[model samples]
Target: MSESKALCTDTELFAAALFQLQVSVWERTADDIPVRVEDGGTIERITPVSVKINGIYYVRSECEFRVDRSGIKS
Candidate 1:
């Protein structure tokens, strides 16, 4: 029989298996219209957790696929 355990840490789980996660996100805006100012502050948090699946709760870390998205391909 195979044994299973709830992941205690992200580092441990990442070392074990390859995870493929897809999720939905939303933009944050104070005004009703969108801004085109690139140099200005963003209206939205990147990869913000707007949804959840099963019994999982995506805090801040879970919102991003990899902690290091620049080095990671997926």
Candidate 2:
């Protein structure tokens, strides 16, 4: 019998690992809040961004979400 192999490329695996690390840092340091969309959806999960303001460094979190419109009423 042949052995199974990983389906993802090396670059893909590295990107996934990096994303997990970012998520860990965000969870530990960011003040995460779930925001409700006007179209009846929720935005969760934090993505950290680094910024320097007046020589001070800070980490800011941004969110990206998709809304489900199928259940919305017209």
Tens-place lDDT per residue, model 1, 1-74, is 32223333545234322433222222225764433222111112222332233333344443322222332343
TM agreement with the true structure for every prediction: 0.20, 0.19
Least accurate 10 contiguous residues by lDDT in model 2: 20-29
lDDT of 2 by residue, 4-70 (tens): 1221233422443343321111113245654422222121222344322223333443322222323
What does candidate 1 score on TM?
Answer: 0.20
- Best-performing candidate as measured by lDDT: 1
Against the true structure, whose TM-score is highest? 1
